[model samples]
Target: MFRPLAVVLLLVSTEPAAAAGLDAASINDAAPPSVKLPGPHQVNASVARLEIMLDRAHFSPGEIDGKLGENARKAMIAFAGANGLSFDKAVTADLWSKLAASSDGAAIVNYTIAEADVKGPFLEKLPPKMESMKDLPALGYRSPREALAEKFHMSEELLQALNPGQKFDKAGDTIAVANVLDAGNPAPVARVEVDKTRQTLSTFDAAGKLVAFYPATVGSAEKPTPSGTLKVTAINKNPTYRYNPDYKFKGVKSKRPFTIKPGPNNPVGSMWINLSAEGYGIHGTPDPAKVSKAESHGCVRLTNWDAGRVAAGLAKGTPVTFVESAR
Candidate 1:
């Protein structure tokens, strides 16, 4: 349960890009989860900083909302795969120590494998390769299956049939990337319909089209998501989150809550498309698979990629219809 050293105050400086040193106060400023009832996901300043670092490395965490959505986690793993770091979403001490030590960390695009790309001893070392999916090792991959999963920010299970037993760091192999768009025609946007009983979000498009679908975490059965047809209110890019203490929960309540700035760690990822349904809207997340399965205070949850597409495509006042689906 140990968190990384926070260096997010650096986020405030108008010249974050120009500053060259890491600050300790930023690391210590992250509020403990136990005190604030941290959401199922870790959205805070420190995680946001990590997202920025990953993006700088050319491993995009997709919107860098301080909330580690599936893209951020996967990007981190991809970076790890390329650089030989562990792929777990939880930041390790080694990763933290490195992040803390480095003034200007590596960017994601910096690790592209080219014959021209120089190879050092650190770069030469890599994970083993697997002959097939069944050949995957204990770490679940002999090659970069998991690594590639993080690269495109997708679930490893989705790529199982393609490359099995690949080490995350293995070079010169074709790893399956996520099918971002469907075969034939790709949809411009995805619409999420919240099902109270199933607690899932069904993705659709502007033409009343059904594109993709998944389960969703909704407002608790008790809180119950407010039902209504709404429109896109506003789109906030890389928004900072303001945690409200007055908000009530089914089991717990907070007297004083803290507001966190936007980054990969914020509960809301890089983009937030507010809906006409008062506080409810569709937004990006750190975890992709967890989208429909987990609980949101009430808002619709989507992967940063999915959300960004939706947010970017639609304008404020875009009609967003919400209907109660079968439980």
Candidate 2:
């Protein structure tokens, strides 16, 4: 397999936004995956950089861990398909060449925790059931760390593992974080394809180039998602969720219907890209890690950040097709 250029030096830089410098030891502590691992997800700085680049281009590879795992492979395949590369092509010199030109070199960088990051009227915790959630004023992050993690498109576990001893409450605490690309969302999306088997979604441009990809939780066995192409009919930001008992949604066993106010923790998450299918569309989730692990009732579910990016460039006539796998 071809590889992108790797950093000659294990570079460390103190990145403070409005605070003190970072600990050099903490930056150096960013390590690769243990060599004892097996399978395709081996930790590679080059792959991590690719993940960052893909994210900048709007195709998120889930968590930006430096490994060519499932999300990385899916993103590559989508890129290949969009660019007219061979469907089964492994990482080729051509791919690396293109990626290097478009991608910033490093996969990891130092970032300081901001004062605003720790400030909040945060929720103590959100109830798991939608019925219980309906009683809350608004569904939001349980902690400042959770809010910061989502902001950086990172997992809270990854953030905690990086910082070690310091409480994340203070600003100016510099930490090693995945260097996600800082570009704006991709140009308007033309269509979106959902792969049910891989549990992924790839957004394409009008010219059919890959704009972005995201891991998704499509429909379930009990209430399978519509397989045919669906048309996007609406985009609702910070949407209020109406829980109607007539639908008999699983885990939501409320006889009386309720309305859940808008927030990040809303059942449909930060945004709702409703489809013409009446009951189904691509939306955000309360749990991003479970996007592919768990099943949705019928709607396609993505992480809030990923879903918002998709929604930002989509509109009422854009096509969304559900397929078993990539062709």
Candidate 3:
């Protein structure tokens, strides 16, 4: 059946790391380190700043979580390449200076929660099964914190870690958040490329210059992505998902066709870019953390914000090339 994309769960730590300088002041003032350090992912001020900078430059680092994870590394590498810098999995000093020079702003800023942020007809709990979601009024966020975290392109864990003891349900409560809301609109895209090997999507201008880059999740082994060239047919915002029984997706036992309502938590997230290939398109996912780390059933998957940004710069008949190797 034409099922909604699979959702992957990611576990993140919410423990506050005051000793590691995870506060707003430290994050805002953090400068890039001259040398790359080897260690496990942890709550780090410098990494947080670097993520914010890369995100602001339109090379999204996926959900900013104060760690130099794979998504962040991919964004850094793409940004380095686009800027004509040599980066070999290490955050070089030259790359850091270039990123800082391009995206000039504080990494973290204080934001007052608005009434609309808490006034949600939020679901108390979202059903795990897709069939169970058909009867729900809307697949909205489960909590105010989830809504706020997605609004600022941050992980829920990072949001909690940044503002400890502060429940996000209260309106007017000021909290520290990543400064990623003002990335600005990218230039019109002339073409799009999805590299399966690198798990990245890049939009290019008419002159063949990179305009924006995003980490994406291509198709999995069971359902490999389409090869060769395709064209964009349509773009839908807050798309309603319709299921067909022929696909017979795993974990879905229903033999009949079904339809799910639209929301950020919907199987397709907030945006859907229909492709020439039937039932195979580039769409957004509910789990931003799994954008590139996880597998997709067949179509390409990007973060909700990244999908929207790409949609804005694209029109009907835009060329979309899918390749197994990096270009």
Clashes of each: 49, 3, 4
Q: Which scores higher on TM-score, 2 or 3?
A: 3
Error of 1 at 249 (Å): 4.4
Model 2 C-alpha RMSD vs. true structure (Å) is 6.2
Model 3, residue 217: distance off in Å is 0.7
Each model's TM-score? 0.45, 0.80, 0.92
* Residue-level lDDT tens digits of model 1 in 37-102: 223243344554565455434344544334435445545444554445553434566665554343
Off by over 4 Å in 3: 1-20, 36-38
| Number of clashes found in candidate 1 | 49
Ranking by TM-score: 3, 2, 1
lDDT by residue for model 3 (247-278), tens: 67777899999999999989999999999998
lDDT of 2 by residue, 239-317 (tens): 9988778878878788988899998889888989999887788899877767787889888999898998899889889
Q: Once superposed on the true structure, which residue ranges of model 1 sit more than 4 Å away at CA?
A: 1-153, 156-176, 179-193, 197-214, 249-254
In candidate 1, where is summed lDDT lowest over 10 consecutive residues?
129-138
Query: Order of all candidates by lDDT, from best down to worst?
Result: 3, 2, 1
